[model samples]
Target: MDVPVLETERLIMRSFRAEDFGPMSAFFADERSFYYGGPLSAGDAWRRLAAYAGHWVLNGYGEWALEEKESGAFVGFCGPWKPGDMPEPEIAWALLPEHYGKGFAFEAARRALRHVYETLNWPTVMSLIEPGNAASIRLAERLGATAERKMEIYGREAVVYRHLPPDLLKEQFA
Candidate 1:
């Protein structure tokens, strides 16, 4: 299954490329990566990237490498994610510190949600956010998601934010 390229006003959501490793690894190395289970070595980052690519092959739908349209820079990734271990499909995203507060994440995520509902035909999706990660919580709320419950995932507690269903999403955003 080929990773479909998705475009937004400021981003190109596509498959992970080798060049994305540098920026990805840098993000993982920084303290900002705490919420992402990062502060990992470059090798770990490479493995993560490989997983992102392989996910498309296995799941037919997975995270996309987010690229800035104008600069063509690797910004981050956002899209549908459901590894075998996960409880359910999720809309996931992670961006570099430089791209934070720029509405890039919001733009990419809204597009991803549309893909999930309109393209993938999923009834609903959830964003698993770490507790106290105010930014993610705010973004989820901004996208009209509501907190559903708390659960332990990957050995950490996470607050699950359920996004609006297809009909509701269309009504709200239309």
Candidate 2:
């Protein structure tokens, strides 16, 4: 599947490339990656990155590499990501710890959610956030998602934040 490029005022969401592996390796090894299921070794990082790349082929849409347009750096990934083990399609993202607190996650996610609802026309999308992850919980809330319930994913309990359909969001986004 051909991944479409998405542009925001401050970011360019695009496909993963070969060079992304190095930074991903570093990202996975960092302690900040805990909430993102990291602290993984280089090999595990490869599998994770490879999974993102392959998801496009299998599902037609998957996670995207978030690039800072001004600095041209790979900040993280944000978009449709469903590994088939989850309860539903998820709109998820993760940024390097240094890039946190700047609203980039929300900015990139708004665009992704718009595409999911407006373009793909999916009924609903969920963000599976770790319960202790206050930052992500806040981001989900800012995106108009409400806490639905608790569930297990990857052996850990997570908060399933449910996002309303795009029509309710259209006015605010417009």
Largest TM-score belongs to which candidate? 1
Q: Please report how far candidate 1 places residue 159 from its true position, in Å.
A: 0.5
Least accurate 10 contiguous residues by lDDT in model 1: 165-174
Best by lDDT: 1
lDDT of 2 by residue, 83-118 (tens): 888778999999987798888999999999999988
Q: State how far residue 22 of model 1 sits from its true place (Å).
A: 0.4
For each candidate in turn, the TM-score is: 0.98, 0.97
Q: What are the clashing pairs of model 1?
A: none
Q: Show where candidate 1 strays beyond 4 Å.
A: none
Question: 1-174 in candidate 1: lDDT tens per residue?
Answer: 888999999999999988889999999999898888888999998998999999999989999999999999998889989989999999998899998999998999999999998999998899999987899999999999999999999899999999999888888778
Clashes of 1: 0
Cα-based RMSD of the predictions, in order? 0.8, 0.9
**Model 2, clash count?**
0
